[model samples]
Target: MSVRLRTALLPLLFLAPTLSPAEAQSGTRPQDVIITYYNALGHKNYAAAYALWDRQGQNSGKSYAAFKNGFAQTYATYVAITGPVRIEGAAGSLYATVPVKVTAQLKNGQQQSFCGNYVVRKNNTGGSAASQVWRIDRATLR
Candidate 1:
């Protein structure tokens, strides 16, 4: 019985070393960053949502105050990842394009729809550890 138990546990030991605790905790995937951004917005956590943008929200093209105020008339928001996220590497960095559909429900019960791509990026070269994690670089919505 001990021999069989050891055999069963052996595979798990091999797999354990392949998984990194830091990677899991960092939410490095591009899709995860997109989801987290929208979820924060939906919950009205503007600061949390804005910080997901690159350059600490500078890449979002709006000041933190303006970004928060843009949603003043929005009662809630929803997002659907409409297609597969694609990641490409360039200049020692990874860029991911995530296609998404979003709906914003206004306080007056009006809904606005947006379809666009969010370009997320991660620095693969030299930077702080936090900079290595994915962040929204830019968004093109219509």
Candidate 2:
């Protein structure tokens, strides 16, 4: 999808602002975070995309430059969520694994599809109400 189209659709993707305390306490799903990540990627907003990664991804031997450069070879990329993302949670754990099917279009005019899982963890360190957020810790793409 084009950047403009993706930008236009972002509002539709995230219908609400911050998650209510009730929703957060019950373990909110990471659908919005995942979709927004894809939106950043679709727009080729490397900085925005990289910012979605949790602390785990940041310290995973790949620097911010590498993370951004990784997409340099791709063009007109589109990430589609094929179905409802299933998030598995454990009692008292702040992390969840979200499995999803994604279709991507590469710059080589090739399309790649994969069933992968994104590890998302919630953090509440920031001072604002919206600071409590779910972030992508790692991605197992195959």
Best by TM-score: 1
Q: How many clashes (backbone N, Cα, C below 3 Å) per candidate?
A: 0, 0
Error of 2 at 123 (Å): 3.3
lDDT of 2 by residue, 1-142 (tens): 6666546545543433334323432345576676667666666776766766766348334888888788776654444455556555455335666676666555565667778777776654445444456777788879
lDDT against the true structure, each candidate: 0.77, 0.61
Best by lDDT: 1
TM agreement with the true structure for every prediction: 0.80, 0.66
